[model samples]
Target: LGYPCRDLLRAWIHELDPDSRQRVVGRAVSAPRPPQLKKLAVLELCTREGSAQVVAQKLGVSRPTLYNWKNQLLG
Candidate 1:
């Protein structure tokens, strides 16, 4: 695994109930972003909207950064 604990963490994130996911994203948006908060937006986009385009636009990340984060967290 690119990330040693990737599978476990992904599983846990995926398993979150709808309300929980929303709450997590809610907190994430208010937190710092760019690098530190990239994953939160990626997770939210993947689980809810499944849109990479929006991730780039919303998170102010470049295409490569968005794709890299997606591969890292959602591989």
Candidate 2:
């Protein structure tokens, strides 16, 4: 399957009940991973206008988080 399909399936499976998922896989499954923010992408967004508030709001993260990501990425 394509990457998109695999990602979709993975997301769908992650949404399944833990018991059902364990039953299907015959083993314990870890919790779904959090969304990862790319350092470069975050830095690039920081460069854009209205990124501090607008972009951060759209991304569901705080404005300070954008700065933290930028600083960490640069260091």
Candidate 3:
């Protein structure tokens, strides 16, 4: 599935109530191999206008790691 833009994602996350966030986390945990929360976090960070280096630094992940997650999530 195509990932939504960062602005949209931020808005969605901001609008989600605590209960809804729990449901999302719960759904992720239900997967056979639960997806990494960091991967999802990286994806969100990429939506911002930051460069790869900045995004990775902010998230404390490598640029390659962010790129890998971006491809996996977007592709």
Candidate 3 overall lDDT versus native: 0.67
Off by over 4 Å in 2: 1-36
- Candidate 3 lDDT by residue in tens digits, 1-75: 799999888778878753454333443232232368656665676677857788778766677867777777777
Ranking by TM-score: 2, 3, 1
lDDT of 2 by residue, 1-75 (tens): 545687777777787843454435566554542435545448657577764688778766667866776676676
* Ten contiguous residues minimizing lDDT sum, candidate 1: 22-31
The deviation in Å at residue 18 for candidate 3 is: 59
Please give, for residues 22-45, the per-residue lDDT of candidate 1 as tens digits: 333443343335655766866766
Error of 1 at 64 (Å): 2.6
Pick the lDDT winner.
3
Alpha-carbon local distance difference test for all models = 0.66, 0.64, 0.67
TM-score of each: 0.40, 0.43, 0.42
In model 3, the Cα lDDT at residue 2 comes to 94
